[model samples]
Target: MIKVLGDSHDKEMYDLLVEVTDLRKFVEEELHVLWKDVDEVRVECQSRHASNGNASISTSYIVVGTHGIKVPKPNMYNNTRNATMVENFLFGLEQYYEALGIVDDGAKIANASNFLHESTQLW
Candidate 1:
């Protein structure tokens, strides 16, 4: 997610139309130009969206281990007896991740491996 959208100017009055609408439009226009394979951007608009978005997304992997919320672990997958409820197991796992603030995919997979029974661990 974008932490900040645009540059901050102390002397300038807060103009929603210029700062928000126009800046968003400039980014959209640039994206359209890129989609069209054109480099016709002659007018450079003041924007910090790229760096702000990158900074936020780059630090996204640093996940908080827990948020102090109670989330019961899903039932272990022992055999085909619980295979019919596989969807429930997946949903519970997702809730566990969200409640525990687990954002990194690698961490989620590694932690989820602990919930798998020996009979289903190969899958």
Candidate 2:
């Protein structure tokens, strides 16, 4: 799903935030655990706005199903889910950088950052 991120850099950053937020939710919900109390998770998203107005963002997520649990490689037949996650992440990064030239208003930066931070509180 392609979204119009922003007129400039802020828009691109906003999109990355949205993508990370979606991916986090999908993993938490779709990949349910047998015992919720037995697991811990960490999600990190890095976002920046360029001075030239083209900044990109990236997110890394790790889930520990149990104490020191390792993530299993997806089976060959189920690559769709993995592809979706990758697509979402890359799309967000691209849109964010694309906005650099378009994000001219200073106030947009504050608003963009606030929205992204609030929306993607995956920590």
Candidate 3:
């Protein structure tokens, strides 16, 4: 289960919960674009073994800020700092427009006339 919390003081902001079997798919499809507005996220995971073995459960928290993302060191029982998982999560948040040849240098000028007319009305 994953829970997302928005601004605390704002009543309009609500919490979101997501249950998933695959973390990679959830990160790429749902969380990639949601990083813009989400302030904090909590993830809970559980695994059950055979009847003779014990069950295990763990939780992790991730905080998002303007400068970057923060993930604390795992506790004694929980170790979720796998290199591959961290790399994948970071890659999903990256903006690759330039590398993908999607940049448009003249995009601003294309709408410059409309912007200027709107700006004049504001005066």
Evaluation by TM-score, superior candidate among 2 and 3 = 2
- Name the regions of candidate 2 deviating beyond 4 angstroms: 1-7, 33-123
Tens-digit lDDT track of model 2 for 1-123: 133434566777889999999999988876676344334321112222222333322121122224443433222221234787656644554344334332333433333333233334232
For 1-123, candidate 1 gives per-residue lDDT tens digits of: 233433344224466556888889999999997966543332221133244454334323435667556777778756555655777777888777877777766567767778778968887
For lDDT, candidate 1 versus 3, the one ahead is 1
**Alpha-carbon error at 9 in model 1, in Å?**
40
Total clashing pairs for each candidate: 0, 8, 0
Q: Summing lDDT over every window of 10 consecutive residues in candidate 1, give the lowest-scoring window.
A: 40-49
* Global lDDT scores for all candidate models: 0.64, 0.42, 0.34
On lDDT, the leading prediction is 1
| Segments in model 1 whose C-alpha atoms lie over 4 Å from true places | 1-61, 64-66, 81-84
Model 1 per-residue lDDT at 43: 26
> Arrange candidates by TM-score, highest first: which order?
1, 2, 3
Instruction: For model 2, give the RMSD to the true fold.
Output: 29.1
After superposing candidate 3, which stretches have Cα over 4 Å from the reference? 1-79, 95-123
Instruction: Point to the candidate with the largest TM-score.
Output: 1
